[model samples]
Target: MASPPPPTSSAPTGFSLRKIAIPAFGPSLLFGIGEGAILPIVPLTARDLGASVSMAALMVALISIGSLLNNIPASLITMRWGERWAIVVAGIWSGLGMSLCVLTSHLGLFATGCLMVGMSQAVYNLARQSYMTEAVPITYRARALSTLGGVMRIGMFIGPFLAAAAVHAFGLQAAYVIGIIGVLGAAVVGARIPDLPVPPHPAGQDAPATPTLVSTLRDHRRVFLTIGVGVVLVSAVRASRQAVIPLWAEHLALAPAVASLIYGLAGGIDMLVFYPAGKVMDYKGRRWVAVPSMLIMGVAMLLMPLTTGFATLLMAALAIGFGNGIGSGMIMTLGADHSPRHGRAHFLGVWRLMSDIGSSSGPALLSLLAASLSLALGIAATGLIALVAAAVLASSIPTRRTGAGGAHEK
Candidate 1:
């Protein structure tokens, strides 16, 4: 394949939604549906296996843990196979993992299966993002990526409903089976579709040395420590919001059905904002989207503990969902913005690792704080941390776009 032309200011004149939607969107949605279906059930499945609440939480944690462990390897795989094949492999791997979860009676095996699902998901996610980096024009980058985030959210929004039907007809294990079917369907779509061209290393020059994870970190140390740290905090806040919401519902004595409905409503609100956010990012700047989004989330978290009933909690949930919606593809967008055209897969892998770490840490931090003090204190502390992260981000990420992938920026 030819090397992509150097960054152009005039926006690829003919760019449209179809260019991105055809191959990437379908697979991403399906993959997300499968993941969403399984996520809520993992803990329940663990509990049924006689695990304690804490242990069940641990089992669920395995998903992020697996992603953290596999991010670098998955990036390497993408580098080797290119985006298309990496996606194909991720779907197959996820299916295998779902099957293991469905078939296993042993808790250990089930956790292993969940871990596999996470690993596959990480690979799948990176491939799609990398493909977009290579394929989409500069002007549409944020909108395209945010739309990708929107599609995933759509699937996630739909998934539990599907899981409910499957479980109602069969059992809890049926959800995993549904997840497997989703994965398989996504795999088929990804396999059949044509992939965007990946540019080859420049003509006549030796390929650039493949940077190891350590070197990538060292090389990008400044961004990672500054703006990157804010992204990590964003991840932490997002994860903590997910963890805290359900626990808050439980604390308020809401029934499972009510809690689910409330949470789903929040998700609905979240799904509504993607396009506008993307538009803002593309036109105004990333910080505009990033700052308000985090501020909203921080305020929501701070207000959460003050809620005395389902109605108040619902308000907080809506705020969180709104915040999350506006920041739909924040991390992916930032990573893509910073990644060079050359050796992008490795850089993205490192980026994913940072995100995965934040994701894992959020829940861990919540659990620790709640255990030592109170859930309210823990929740409030998380809110304060998010507020701080927003400040960091405001001061960090470059204020001007230097074309697609921020190719010209340091």
Candidate 2:
């Protein structure tokens, strides 16, 4: 085995959100708007092109599948091209994909376009997450990351409203154009922003000695198999919430415009808790936030099928938002926590690959269950899985908390 490398240099001193995070915020916001604007409408668009609800959901699932497939490539790109360039390129790519979606009239073509957007999302997100992990001080890791997640939520809160307006003015297909605009705008912003300085490599490590992906994955196999699995299930429940809610709204015969509006409103609740959740995780422990977030989401999904009207469903959506919002950045945070500092990009790539697997499969699983049994039963089954995930996380994660109020991980 190679001798342990010398201690790495510290992150830049003093944490200022304005100094560190603000530069990246604009691109994050714009990209989130682009994605959020399109996501709620993807299933609706598929339905318009002669798809059953299950098939429509599957079309939406393609985004995650594309993301899953692209994780390693995304990581490789980030490692070689650097974060700034990768993000700018990703935005341009996503904009092109959205343009395809806007121009296409067929469901298959539209789904293909969305697949490209998903691939772009994976690259863009990996760059941003890797940047955050490298730049921010460990003590403030959760807060910084959570704030980043909150910014995305803010954009998401705004996106559905814009989508509703676009649908009203043009048509469901025209709504995709909004995403194109947002993505191009993001690319412009990202291009203008400077790349943050990453922490210096450990001494004795040559600048040219970047580690290979295969070796990194092999080194981190234990964490990847155990804690990583729980993170994937957590991601599944999160992705399911996104996929299930709008579909559930459609199932209840709510107007597409109205459904988008309610989903947007729930996102408002989601944006509200980012900082507090980060604070809890930093001080109280990961389990404090992780367990309750999963439990709340699981219970809300269980009750989702029982809702007969907009009001009851709206309550369920809000509950889900509460759960999701509190856990904003949780998966990424966990990945950062476990990743080796030396080969972080490769480890994160595999880490994200696992989560994206859950993200991709969650919708397919839900759709399959809906087809095999009933829609309600499918949702309930996800709820059960989520509860089991909560148990797995609570049992597996160490009870360590950092900073002044830090406690042992549990």
The sequence of per-residue lDDT tens digits that candidate 1 reaches over residues 13-98 is 67787865858799989988998898889999999988899999888878888889999999899989989889999999999998
lDDT by candidate, in order shown = 0.86, 0.82
* Candidate 1 wrongly placed segments (more than 4 Å): 1-7, 198-207, 401-410
Worst 10 residues of 1 by lDDT: 1-10
Task: Give the distance in Å from residue 360's predicted Cα in candidate 2 to where it truly belongs.
Answer: 2.1
Error of 1 at 11 (Å): 2.1
In terms of TM-score, the best-performing candidate is 1
Error of 1 at 173 (Å): 2.9
